[model samples]
Target: MEHHRSISDVLIIGSGIAGCVSALTMAEEGVHCTVITAGERLSYGNSELAQGGIVFHAENDEPEILEKDIMTAGWNHNYAKAVRQLCALGPDVLQELFIDKLHIPFNQRKPGDWFLTREGGHSLPRILYCHDHTGRNIMEALSKAVSEHPNITVLTKRTAIDLLTTHHHSSHMDFKYSLANSCVGAYVLNEHTAEVETLLSRYTVLATGGIGQVYLHTTNTPGSIGSGIAMAHRAGARLLNCEYVQFHPTALYAGKRGGQRFLVSEAVRGEGAVLVDSCGDAFMKRYDDRADLAPRDIVTRAIMDVMLKTGDDCVYLDAARNIKKDIVKRFPTISERCRNISVDITSEPIPVVPAAHYFCGGVLADLNGRTTLERLYAVGECSCTGVHGANRLASTSLLEGLVWGVTSGRDIARRISKTEPMSEKLRDSIRDWVNAGDEHNEDPALINQDWATIRNTMWNYVGISRSAGRLHRAFSDMRTLAKNLQDFYKNTPISKPLVDLFHGCQTAYVITLSAMRNRQSKGCHFRAD
Candidate 1:
């Protein structure tokens, strides 16, 4: 196979907020960066689908107070150091990067005063939003800046096939004898050209977002199938808390509306929306004292229990009677989407169900975004910094991504300056991606069936509630499916769908195995047995 090589100071395998932020931070310091996305559009990802808001410092808000809220939501399972770093430096980073540098027009009460809103798991109104389209607005600004920046190169429709580790990809046998493994770059598949390119860099960052798409129902973008996690796992990066998959309590229930569901922002509940039965009877108060304000895990489980007991397909989110603000104006995006499905948020209740939303577990990384592997960093949803712990706090996802993006970018810039470039011999030792079988052997029908089996198995046996029996069955089934997919993957031509299925299968197996090993019912990893 012929090889095409591209070099950069940094290679970021995502185009979301974290990727964009990291690129911008490094580029400003004269470091060249290459940002790639599997999606056709640079702005398409889980970050673009975010609606609730990003956490900020509210009036009289202290780092300790925010830390307490986060710990409470995470059930005291959070890494105290990571939580401390985020709570202390997050606001400053937000101000410097988003406000001062990017000039993102976040909503304001008046000049000099920002419009802060609350969300589930937050103690106060400490979230900044751009109407109900916070992620969209933030991405628009970041993507534009990244595209125009002279030091940053944006590549779309490029899927990362695997991380290029010295121990794994090097043609030299001596590299295998080295005590430590270092990531040199990645083998990326260029969709437009149908060719795999060797993308080499001094440093590599994985900002690839959530794993929600692995489930049957999710509030994530289509490409979020745990590709980054699978790639990192293949490279032997340490993974933490792989069982904690957070399910959003209120995804609009439009039956058979593809895999991606329209998320009813938690800000709606923060604005006074209440979860009720079909008969308009409020039920959250029965589950927790905080009722609608409870952490996502509690709320998601409560909704599931309600559904199981009542034998209903979905529950109702009554925003019409509770929220005093004009629903249309305050949540225009929600209103518009709801309207498309013949549901009016201003006058009626929204049919809602819990859907796979966020993954609290991922490749282990530190506060500076350094993973266990040398020269490889992970930020955003893909990296488990131990900040979110067993469950994520509402509105903290964006803040976590932002804080780490800036820190990782700055750290990489500093490290790269002192680090020597890869030697010509070492660089040449990295082998090109090879095709193992006939390109025409890939069957789309078989791939789609495999995906369906994985999704259905995950949703049924490993979803909101789980048991020893269910998890055991899930592990058995996924283990078999993963092996089959691996075999199919080796012999099939590398297409985007084929690659996604392979990654998805591997990720599903990881999550299932993790779920089976942990017997405790904590946060999102609720083991009924």
Candidate 2:
């Protein structure tokens, strides 16, 4: 098979907030980076779909208050150090990189003053936003800056197949895992060309986003099938907390079959929008003291309880009755999305249901974003820094990405300056990818059928609530599916859907196994039995 080769200081496997922020940071440090993305566009991940905002410490907000809110939201399972770092560095990172440098027009109260918005589990309005589409605006600014950077290269529609560790090099001792030795780079598949490329880099950062697509319903992008997590796992990187999947309590209940659904921002609740039953009765107070303002896990469970008791498919988010301000002006994206679905947010209650939204657990990385593997780092939703612990607080996802992305970029820049580049001989030793079969013998229908099975199995058994029986069953089923997918992956030629399916199966296996081991009902992993 024909192939391509490239060398860089760093190879980033995503192009969302983490990838863009890190690329911009490295470019400023005069480091060369090549960003490979599965999506053709820059803001294709969950970052752009973020309708709420990014969390930050405002002038009146104290570290202790921020820490308390985060800990409470995470059910006290948060890593104190990581949470402290996020709270401390988040404001500075946003101010310096986003506001001062990139000039993202975040909604401001006045000139040079940030317009802070409140979200669930926050003691105060410490979340900064750009009107409603905070992520979109932030992404636009970062994408422009990254595109103009001469030292950074953005390769769209390139899917990462696996990490290139000592196992891939003939001269070096073959190690089973990435943690056993240093990571040189990765095997990248060019989607347009149908060719594999050996991308060798001094450092590799896995900024690929979440694993939300594992479930039947999610608020994540279609490409968010845990490809990075799967690749890192195949490289033997330590994945922690895969079981703690955060279900956003208010994804617009479009249908069970939709790949991605509109997220009714938690800010809607923060603005006094309340969850109601079909009978139009406010129901949050019966679940938690915080009511509509409780942490996401609590709200999701509460909604689930209501659904179970009422035998309803979904609950309603009534914003018109509570929100004093014009709903359309506040949430233009949401209003338009609702209008598209023939629901008027200004007058009627929008139907919503809990769906898999974020992965709190991922490849274990330190505050510096260094993974268990040497010369390899992870950031954003793909990396579990333990900041979110068992559950993520609303609006903190974007903050985590910014803080960790910059930290990882700086760490890589410092390390790469000290370490020598890969030798020509070592780089050449990484061989081309060879396909075992020439025929496209695999049935797409079978693949899709198995994919749907994986989703339904996860949604029913390993969803917001789990038991020993359900988890064990999920684990067994996923293991069998994984084996079959692995067999197919070994034989089939490289395709985006096939690659996504292969990674999704691997990811589902990891999460199911993790969920089965952790018995306690903490945060999102609630056990009914």
Candidate 3:
């Protein structure tokens, strides 16, 4: 086993929105924090892939309208209070960024107001944006702010394989409540050095984003391996509905997007882009009255239904006819991608497909972002805080990250201030999860094959549209996949790709299980009877 070290006030996994925000917030309280990231850069997460802006109900916008829109998108089974909290606090946190934090730069909108872009679902314009790459801009702002803070340390190219636990550390201390005596630290692998090390903290936050890359195609970054949620599940956290995965209605058709034709944001549709058939015919009107502006669940299903009938590999999102052709300046990155990839907005339609985008279910948590496990707080996509329900409305992601990141940080600050640092025994317990230098099976091909099976199972059965048969098949496939991986993982040496692939495979199993258990057509989880 690798040697472990127990230190820090808080240890954060996944240095995206939640991680950055939480680190900065806690540092303000004089608490020293360490952030272990899975990539070379801070934004090397699903957060940077989001092209759309965030949703916020400002003074001019009615909160009830936002609530209704989100509830409808989530299919009404959403956590009402939590969703309401999101709606209530969203605008305030946004206001804090623009007004107090002084981050936003001439936000593109009417003078004295923030730019409100429309997306797939909302009846009114409630999205607060900073051009097309709102997520990147937001992450950059938080990352800059956090990196400058002395109390917070950012460890890049460090992937956290599993969470460190007090119970797992010592024999006598039965860590029944992980939060109370929980999360001593985490097991981190330095990608550069190719060595495993232990990181300990009073509080551990899993800000890891979506599991889109579990499929063959996704807008998510390849690093989005469901690390946090999977690690939390293994640590005895009961996961909620993991099946409700949202397939973005407008991902550029590709086997996998490593920064190529990643996505044409839904805001393009909101600006009057239309969905056209292969015959150059507009078809969305037949699907919904809102047509090009319909909610994501409706539009995605319509796209699938149309494709099924036509036997086509893809559908076209026609941006040629609208004044939105002039609006291409708003999305410079997308425009360049379109130009290089044989698409001209003024002349041709963009080929599109519904790709797995976000996972709405995770370790269930309350408003304060505290999970079932004590001392283990979750925020952002890693925690199923009941905000998204079955489907997440466009732009609510950054909102949750900011809100819960701060809230959870406040809880962490209180914990660290109240208690003494962990004992020496807890530090020793963390090193056991890592089998350092104990070389085992070295076949990369075998590990890759296991990963392929997992991805194919998720894409085929737990995909855009699912049914009882498909869900059952997916469950069975994932069960087999999980069992196979258990052996492969025990035997394989610890490599970054293998570790990421391993976590993703386990997450796929939970998602498939969640889909099979929730036998209803709701939001992104459509069950074709």
Candidate 4:
């Protein structure tokens, strides 16, 4: 095994909004940061797929109102401090970063007034969008800024294998005797050369996004397989709300049960699209008085119940009949995507189903994004700040990522200036990655099969609804699968698929275990028995 080493003031794993914001924020303070991602492009994550907009301050809106909406949506399980921080700072950060700094072309009603839209859990229309392609537009501008920044280095096609912690990766026995476990950096695999590089940094941030890919059907990109959570958990970081996985209520259902599902943005429902059964009977009113505007958990269960009762695999979103706005103009991307499948949003209903979308729980972190482990931080969907609690309000994902990204970045920069880098002797004591298997023995077929088993197990047993029997069976199956994957990982050469599969399996075990431990139903972690 060959070894290459690089050092930076800050190391950011995952190039989504959170990672980019962290990098840019620190870089502005003269900190040289390295941002890495597993995908070929920096824009290949959930942030880029965010069709809805981010939260902003609407007219006559108070921070307390937004806080109440968030707490209500989260079933009062939210961390009040985190919620308050988001409501207080989110709009200002959005204005400073996206509006004033980047000058992103968000939709505008006039020369001075911006166009705002509503989502499922909001009290008013407070989301700022760029038509329906808000994320694409935001990522495009943000990635460009990151690429051009002299203090930031963007490395694509780099997969983070694991966190480098003193308690685990240190070669010195005496260092393990210390009370604290500190992370120095990570072992990152360069996909182009298949070489593991030791990326040492004064501060390491895990913004690796969500765990949607762990389920059979999801709106997340293929890369979102809980790598960050798996790495943090292995490094002894505390995880919170692992059982609360939020399923989006309306994913475009094309009669498929697996792979990435096209998301029917909740903003569509906010625009008046109603969920109806095959017989065109509106059913959300039966479950919640808010009907189409119910929170994601309520909407998802309603859709599921309707599907089960009607013997239908999917329901329909009738935007054509309800939304008075020009459907094609308001949602050009959705219209085009539906057009490809011979369903025009302007004329009829679009087929939809529930799919895994977001993870409200993750590696426990604070408002500053600092994890339990020293010198390591987590932001974005990968970190549980306790803001989302049991379920996330629509469009808040992007805002949380942005706000925490800036906060974490500023916190790291402020601290890094006074702290010295790791000593040479201590750095030298960290060992490099060593491969134990024949590189030729790696089989794509086996990796694919393992991933399939993981996704199917999560979706079937621990999905939108759960029972004790289902959770027990899931735990048993995942336990066996975890052991098998551990053995396979030890014997197989490193690859992107292999690393993702290993992480996915570990994450599945964590989620299932968390579900089994909790007896009461709260938000998204509903138990049938």
Candidate 5:
């Protein structure tokens, strides 16, 4: 069959805030852009799951306060320049996304006051919210905007399995044309159509979000398979600090099979939700004087410690006592989800457990969101832009995505003028990949299980706390899993699940490798070594 996909100016591999913002910026520049997304379901990316809301300095809020809080929360190791830049740019990005383009219906106090709320780790009320489902609000707005764009094509349910490259170019003159050397585009697998297609572009942006799904128990969506980071690593992009994983303090724990729990928004705590022990005693005050407003790592460990010491099934989140029944009416979405599970926030405490929530590290990128790979950009939770070092401040992931996404897109658009479109040589390499896509065959089902193995290994060894011994064990487990996955992937027929699993294997090893390098306990990365 003849390949039909024409080259785009830039092919972005996600549909969340980052990818959408990138597309918006690129389209304005008249750079033809295409976004290849994880699923047809809108806002399926982690951005839509962010309940804490986007952190930005309201005009009334002090900039120094936000900066100090972030610096202190991230333990001072985070990149000051990037963090400062992000913080400075936060309001602009927020305005661009929420007010200028997506038209998110932000709650307001005085005509146009972005009714801000407070979350853990912030000293001031700085988060802009839309009821309780902030991600949903933002996602809804962005989806509408992107779908209407003429220059931007949003390809849903298409996973960028591997980046198209020529690291070892077919022609000597091509000289390592690669996502590693320089991105040509990506090999995307469309799940609904069951066809593998080669997508070509001058720039390929990986806005693929977080890897919290690497843990057996996590708050991330099923799509958070670490595909972008894993593919980027294989394409020879530099990765950093893959070890640091953040655990949210309170997920509505309902005894899931993998101990997986539904995310109860940090905004609950931001809205005065209290943490209580097994005996129904308010306990966060005992752990940290800041109480419900403590940083996520501290909050997670505190809950875990209480659970371990009391030998209880889980702790309780007790907002029923302080928060109003009427406000619960306002947050009907969250209130009802909890109520459906028989945990009425108006009368009883919700059973809570800590679950892996965010990855603080990933494929390293610069201030402009440019990865080591030329013409390849990344934003959101997937790229370690150093704005988040060992830990990320609440609501900052989407904020970072907003700033870097726009910046990266404009830069790529400017660079597109000097670069040639997808070459015949590059297309041939991608053709070979797509041809190999049809040629090879192996057990995809077994490859799927390796993903579980990776999740189990991370959750067991490199979870909320870690030690040299545990890390070593994790490395061993990761290696074994990787070997099995590589063998399976090499021998298997090309499929979306297979590609995702192969990515998982690379992610596990990279995370383990990054974990083994860091020796101190700081922020999300806790180590006894």
Candidate 6:
């Protein structure tokens, strides 16, 4: 009964760093923006769970060096243009927005000097962190700013079902699929009331973060189920590098099931922590010269190799010996989390394993964040600006989100002032979303079973180390599972849980299919065969 339609200058999906930054930036430009989130609060995404810091340049750093590090980590498959934009624009944005404007209290070594740390694949210490919970601290500042912004509105517990496009109005329309395919808004489902609303906007941005929930073990938050990517794909948006899923090298191996896993920050390694086996023997030296400092792909593969060779469930990170004194002070969040679980970091080695951490690819966009579709843009982990290439360097995700968020926000705000609002006829033509079927999914157990199957299939076949046979099998299984889900979807009432399952399946299928297409072994998507 609460079903309705609304309009805004910009409608940003996902309340992570990218979405919040975009909204705040646009609001500053006098644009009325709306941010919709799947969780109860804006801080529920992967941004808040990020343990490592944001990457930025030091005064002595050169753009070429930063570019080289990113390209090398990505195995040179990166979009040169996007990478360059990030390298050049990131520092200014950090100073102007995060430091000067927002006044974020980043950790500092001395008065007026930032406390910088290095992560894997970076040449130097160019990362500015706030203790170990860098992302959480950043999110806290962003969330507070967004809440106080007069031109911004934040909606929680809303799930975007699909994008509203011109094609949705008429099947017989002759509009070209190129730039003519514009996104006017989105159809969103209210989780609390089970009502769907048409949220119309001059520009629609998808900053829905990563697709890590499709994997069995992930360092991503629960809300990262790939809804934006799925909805965009369904609406004919071009997605690039879908195969490049970055598995973080070290996630706390709690042997737990469901929800997000605890991340062991790469900064721990930067502080001299080494990956060791059950016998306390360091082994990364045999795999790569950089050893613990190697790129995420190399490190994750090395960990997997160690686990297989040793027949152990996980490896140990010896931070106790390397970072003994300031262990609790330097990484208070990690220390407290481990202590809660009865694992004292200062006295014992932390058990860790590789887990799906970030999605390097998504709705393909330019440096300005414009996607193939007209009036539609994507940023953050959900957008493939190609800054991350085939694999992401550590701590670069937050910076990428910040840069693109500002780019998209400024561009959208400028265009909104010049462009006319969507026509009333076209808006009316976008059919009211109806759940239709009176029947519930009689067996809710089927949803859980299918969800588990998709995650397990991706983990077993399409994970860190992939093969042609494995990819093929995963593709087939996902395709079949998708069809079954589609059938059930048509007959059941729309709900957030069901939509999340549907989106997860679509994202998994895309990843598997992309992996199958790229036969060559490269960053992240490594094929042993």
Clash counts for the predictions, in order: 0, 0, 5, 0, 4, 0
After superposition, candidate 2 runs with Cα above 4 Å error: 168-180
Model 1 ranges off by over 4 Å = 256-258
Which residue pairs collide, candidate 6? none
lDDT of the candidates, in the order given: 0.92, 0.88, 0.79, 0.92, 0.80, 0.89
Pairs with backbone N, CA or C atoms under 3 Å apart (clashes), candidate 5: 166-177, 441-493, 442-492, 442-493
lDDT (Cα, tens digit) per residue for candidate 6, span 188-252: 99877779988988799999999999999998888788888899999999999999999998998
Candidate 4 residue-wise lDDT, 360-450, digit = tens: 9999999999999999999999999999989999899999999999999999999988998878867888888988787466687988888
The prediction achieving the highest lDDT against the true structure is 4
Q: Candidates' TM-scores?
A: 0.99, 0.97, 0.94, 0.99, 0.94, 0.97
lDDT tens digits, residue span 1-529, model 3: 4454548878888788877887888899999998878888798888876777878655567878888888988888799999888888878876786446856653555666776777877878777777677787777777788778999888899888887666656454444344454666778888877777777777788888778778876778888778888898988766786878888888887433322238788988887888887988889999888888877778889998888999988899887788534666777777777777778877788888887777888888788787777678888887898888888888888788888888888888887888977776655444455464355666779766876777777888888888898888888888877887777678667888878877998888888888888877888888887
> What shift in Å separates residue 367 of candidate 6 from its native position after superposition?
1.0
Q: Look at candidate 1 and tell me the lDDT of residue 308.
A: 92
Instruction: Give the least accurate 10-residue stretch of model 5, judged by summed lDDT.
Output: 430-439
For model 3, the superposed segments whose C-alpha errors exceed 4 Å read 1-4, 109-111, 173-181, 254-261, 428-440
Q: Root-mean-square deviation of each candidate, in angstroms? A: 1.0, 1.6, 2.4, 0.9, 2.3, 1.7
Candidate 4 deviation (Cα RMSD): 0.9
Rate residue 474 of model 5 by lDDT.
92
Order by lDDT, highest first: 4, 1, 6, 2, 5, 3
Error of 6 at 208 (Å): 0.5
Q: Candidates 1 and 6: which is better by lDDT?
A: 1
Off by over 4 Å in 6: 170-179, 256-259
lDDT-best of 3 and 6: 6
Error of 5 at 522 (Å): 0.9
Cα RMSD (Å) between model 2 and the true structure? 1.6
Task: Give residue 403's error in model 3 in angstroms.
Answer: 1.0
Using TM-score as the measure, name the better of candidate 4 and candidate 5. 4
lDDT of 1 by residue, 386-465 (tens): 99988999999999999999999999999988988888877989988888867577777887788889899999999998
